[model samples]
Target: MDNSNSNSNSNNSHEGCYFNRLLEYTSDSVEFYPSFKNSTLFTAGTYQIEQGDTEYKERRKGRLYLFDIEKDNKVKELQSIDFNSGILDMKWTHHNNISQQYENDAPLLGVVMSRGELNVYRLNAADQEQGERRLELVCRNDVSLDPSILTLSLDWRTDNKEIVTSYSDGSLALFDVDGGAVTNRWIAHDYEAWICAYNYHNTSMVFSGGDDCKFKVWDTRTIEAEDGGRSNSSGATPIFTKRCDMGVTSIHCHPALENIVAVGSYDECVRIWDLRSMKQPLTQTDSLGGGVWRIKWSPSDNNHLVTACMGGGFHTLSSEDGTFTDLSIKSSYQGPHQSIAYGVDWSYTNSSSTDKQQYIGCCSFYDRCLSVWTP
Candidate 1:
């Protein structure tokens, strides 16, 4: 597909390094552990909260902090740095995003930014803020894999030592954590490749969605280095490509289904595709009003799917037949309705032995707010 018809947003440019929406806060910002047993929400952007026995919060200026939420909802201030690099996405590790070699020591989580920089930091156990636990840079690609990338997704291979990241630049690259280099790179789409995921049930499978309005299923096993690895430097060749309509920003696999995948797009639609029929989506659901940015499959249930959109709203969809119902918490605070929901994660935090409901962690862009929703 030719990108000639694409309209460019200046704020999306990496060279300018200007974020259009900035959240300004007044007064000394108070940090709350949203995961705490007593708190209902956790807010952290300008300040760092270390929740534990001491319960202390350290404030920072001009730095974005990465906080690790424990099972108890306690937030551990993980990493803090001065750079205002727009972190597009981050993935937590079962072992770590970095390597098993460091598992015995400090495991690392991978953070991808809009500036095309990737960083891996050793997660340190903290009771409080000690001098500086600076994040270690395993690899930094000064230039983006896709120059015009609007979104990113990082998923570790079944082995956990390898990570594959998809970009809006219409490309997908697989990196070996130990080698600290990209093992495979494929031009997956014509427009922005928004989101990507690995089929955890099947190790060799992967998927990506983007502005081209297509969701593609790929078999890494058939994909080999394009130059036959004869020159030993040319990247891998994509073995398969499929197309679906409307610029997709999010793509995820059905937690229990083998060949089923779902994608969300700019056309305000969510589509599900089967590998057997790739030309058109098998199922499609319209977004009530907003452009959906992220779609996630519930880790706890195979039939439940969740999505967050740009208009400060979210929805829960039934995977049984692609039917969706609106789901957002009632805000008593009556705060800003412009909170663009950028990130969402499902947690089994408060589940009891007999109860099966899962909690969700959502991050808002405009307000820099993180909210926990129980459903």
Candidate 2:
């Protein structure tokens, strides 16, 4: 396949808008699980191969790579770590006083394993002068749930001490980092809770979506009754609930815009909602042509968002108008032809002041590829 391709819809209002690929990386047989923190990129994946006619075996071992963008606008691999399990998700916490103690130390990284374990790692900046520094495992915690349940998604609080996770068993849990224990756990949905997120402006509240085809909001304070007994009856009731045509696949609260959120569903539409009034969506886009697996709001631009469509490839949606409109940037890989776009994130660093150009990093599942571009 050609490494780069460009095409645009003639009917698209913004026909001149095009996405230029800045970096492309492909793995031989392993898939890439990619995440970004500022200018640095991290990826991990497992290797698998067929053993015989009907049996297959996984190497179990996984590899993690770190890439940093240089002054000349080139990305270079800075470090690699070997792990015993495949990585499902990775997040970097906000820079806080605790993380600022060490000079040149990278932000704390939270790693979610495919087998239901959460590990925190930090870059060892103390020995950079001596030799190549590596990541040090600072803390590890196992989310105690049904053995069959896998942690599907997680979000860190801005304070950097707590993390909220969603599980395959349709449950949500809050974990305390210092205490190394689950602070709270509740059943949030009837089926797999695919996504859970913290409202950045209001940390006490959380939002989650699941295969049950519902988007719900929860308040942590209501976990226990006034008498101190667990409130099993009313505790599970969400502050608000909205049903979609298909399973809700992803949910993201706007980073800067409070009360505004972007919700994606298996129905191939991304709906923008205002928390104040949920009777109807503020605006809904036309069919995006695939299950929207991930939605990321650009840190640089408030009106822009990027979607990882499982079947339609990648798309950039802008809300500068009253409603969200598709920019129709060029995408080389559409689903069913190669693989589904599973992971997508926007880089926080933006050098341009006039033009709203920021780096976007995306990874495809079965294609085992990662690409960075600007739309």
Candidate 3:
């Protein structure tokens, strides 16, 4: 596929919002996890199973692929591993820990499986030079939850040692990598907790959105009981809850700004909220056609964001005027298509010298494809 296209505004406005497809990849199943860190992009491919397919008894596996962003702005496949189960969510640690007197230490990758298993793997440099094309991830720790409950989403703590996961059964869990145990777990919502994330600025605070149409804030410090065991009740009460027009789908905290959060809902709108006051959203974007499934803040810019709309293709949003405009993808084709954009993420590395262009990766559900572009 040609990776170049002219940059043009969606409606000829002055915001200069435009994106061009740079690369594309096809997978066997839907690609759910598209994470970018350092100079590598980590993606997991998962296939959907029929509800009553009794003939397919064997456990299905998935592929974990790694792509490196080259200096010439092209992506090269680095390695791939066939995991035991389909990955629903994956996150790369933010801290590398190499500067903390650890020799040759690379960041950890946390993988959440469809069967409710959580595993942490260390990227070993020793395996990279073994002459084999594929690099093996050294398993550092593995924690399995109740096999009946499926994990939906997960976020890594800034320390790169712990992770918090949301589940299908309206529960939240925190796992410690070094100790290989679940440090805390609680009933967080009344319905499926679709998304959960750590407030990188404050490790004690977590943000979660659920199918209950509520966005909630959780404090881990209060989850402990007075007697030093897990609390029997729901543990701690939510610090705040904001009801939305539809079920909440995604939430992303601002990378640089403290207390600022971007929330996406099935109502087809993205709302920016301030944690100090939950009375109202600071700004809400106009509809982007289909429901907003994913929202990602740019790692390089605090004011920019991108979203994967279920029916709206993909969009680039700006917060310059305290409101969201339709800076969606500009295309010659018109009208609705059947593809559902399920995953979206921004590359941590900038592709342009002036920071005018950055790499973005997105995957579609029905289409079973991954696209790398810039907006």
Candidate 4:
């Protein structure tokens, strides 16, 4: 896959660093728990199952693996847990205030199971009888009454009190983290709702993209499922919507900005948008050479955006004043993984404000490869 045809408005002269393999394992998704800043600890969900199959059969192929990011750039596996089908996405709840003791003194994890459910887990300590050191199921919320309706992705609401999940059946669900129940749901797309997120700056706002090629915005406060947790009624209509050239696959709300969101699609382009005005994209980048599967904004730097572009590889872009102009590869075809880049995440520990270098965790499907990109 030659990348000569693409255009990145800025020179990608990687003078001081190069891509290096920090781990070798087949994984479908990877995420770092911010609470482990002193010693970075992350989780990797394996496989990339499609649709939904017999849960009892596909469950054997899905496993969530834990790894610790070491001081010397090497990683070690800490533990592993079994599950029903592949994990399409994993998100650890973030803490805005460090003093509050959360569930089991650890951040809660919500995983999008390809078997049509969103499962939450808590990390328990393996030694002192604390649960934060091991992955333990907290609760399971099945978005669809039908077990085969796979959930594709999920996002933690800005307050970390609720969750919004996208499903393969073209619907969305709002799950309350503390309540461990689906508060609301509705049909939001004509095709698969590939991705969804709550705008960080607005508590009542949400955005979704689907295989139907529509980018829609909703006012969560006003959306009421016409029929208990399932509906296509006018009561659930989105506030704003626009069509994309292709299926929208990924979306990430900026951590520190208002009305700013980055969206990626099957068209292989990344677009920056200001939620206030959706008539046109604020900025658009050249083709990334593959389907953009997942996206993450640097926790410490909102200007930096990372994405897993299936065949093209993983990328890090510079977004200045909402413009994603300086695009560069953190890992690509010339590097590791040789398969569909299904998941990627930025390390909060190394990318702190005082640190100049950044570490990224990425996983590829099919071949099941997991690697860290060290600068």
lDDT per residue for candidate 3 within 205-245, as digits (tens), equals: 89999999999998888776332223224756888999999
The models' CA-based lDDT, in order, is 0.52, 0.63, 0.63, 0.71
Best by lDDT: 4
Native RMSD of candidate 1 (Å):
12.5
* TM, every model: 0.65, 0.76, 0.77, 0.83
Error of 4 at 337 (Å): 1.5
lDDT of 2 by residue, 1-375 (tens): 232221211121222222222212322111111222334434433332323564221323345555543333344455666555456566666532222322344567777654567888776553657543456789987774543466777777777788888878788888888888777778888898888888776878889999999999888777643222211133577899999998898888876677888999999889888888888888877788889888877665667878888778778787655243333333333322256666777665444333334556666665565455555
Candidate 2's C-alpha lDDT?
0.63
Using TM-score as the measure, which candidate wins?
Answer: 4
Worst 10 residues of 3 by lDDT: 6-15
- How far residue 281's Cα lies from its native spot in candidate 3, in Å, is 0.8
Residue-level lDDT of model 1, residues 1-375, one tens digit each, is: 222311221132222111112233211111222121222222233322223563121221224454443343234444545543455666644321211223253444566655455666553444465632344555565325433343366766656677778766677777667777676677777767777778755778887776777666778876665432212223444444555456777777665566666677776677766766666666666543567787766654555667776673666666443332223322211122246655665553234323343455555664655444454
In TM-score terms, candidate 4 sits at: 0.83
Over 1-375, each residue of candidate 4 has an lDDT whose tens digit, in order, gives 232311211222233222323222346788887653423567888753434674543543477877765544456566776664667778887643322324245677889877777888887666665333567788887766466777888887757789899888788888877777777888889889999987867778888999999888989888765555654443488998888799999998877676778889999988888777878878788888888888888765657778899988877877555444444444343255678888888766433334444577777776666666663
Give the residue spans of candidate 3 off by over 4 A. Answer: 1-40, 50-52, 55-60, 69-74, 95-105, 126-144, 225-235, 321-338, 350-357
Every model: Cα RMSD to truth: 12.5, 7.4, 6.9, 7.3
Cα lDDT for residue 44, model 2?
38
Whole-model lDDT, model 3:
0.63
lDDT of 1: 0.52
Supply candidate 3's per-residue lDDT for 62: 56
